[model samples]
Target: MNLTISVVLLAGIALAVVLRLKSATLTGAVIALLFGFYLADTDAAPTVNELVTAIADAVRGIGN
Candidate 1:
């Protein structure tokens, strides 16, 4: 559950970056989010989840 929240927070940050850069519109962000939702339902979701977990672990290890 924590990892899921982390992923969502990171994705929101990404959208904010895009907005700042003027490279993405609100519609584009909505479409991207929908795409992510669809992708998460696919078989690739596990791989993505594992990758996020690994990244989170590495960041945590860096602090310790």
Candidate 2:
């Protein structure tokens, strides 16, 4: 993937693991982003949905 995508993914993972802010699912959402860009021929809304799931996971993790 491109540098920007890689950076963003790592940042998300780092935040989730190191900062203990986000959740494990966040990693997948960030990676899915690459699909939206690389496969412009398809849809993009799904990625946001995946992101929402990640946010939910993060929130749940915080509670537990």
Candidate 3:
């Protein structure tokens, strides 16, 4: 649960940075966000969660 929140926060921050740099338009960001929101409700959510968790664990390992 904590990892999920962290990932979301991190992604949000990244999106904000991209927006500030004008690298991505607001419309594109909105579309991408909506895609992800809907994607989370699909069968692939579990796989995505597991992949995120694994990546997080690997990142933690690198800092150890």
Off by over 4 Å in 2: 1-42
lDDT of 3: 0.72
Better of 1 and 2 by lDDT: 1
**Model 2 over residues 1-64: C-alpha lDDT tens digits?**
6554554445445555533544447555655565445444446557877988999999999978
Angstrom error of the Cα, residue 61, model 2: value is: 0.8
Scored by lDDT, model 1 comes in at: 0.74
Residues 1-64 of candidate 1 have per-residue lDDT tens digits of 3544445555656667776777767776784686587668768789999999999999999988
lDDT of each: 0.74, 0.59, 0.72
- Top TM-score hit: 3
Candidate 3 Cα misplacement greater than 4 A, ranges: 1-23
TM-score of each: 0.60, 0.33, 0.61
Clashing pairs in 1: none
The list of candidate 1 runs beyond 4 A from truth reads 1-22
> Residue by residue across 1-64, what tens digits does model 3's lDDT show?
3544444455556666776777767765875596577668768789999999999999999988
The TM-score, computed over Cα atoms with residue i paired to residue i, of candidate 1 is 0.60
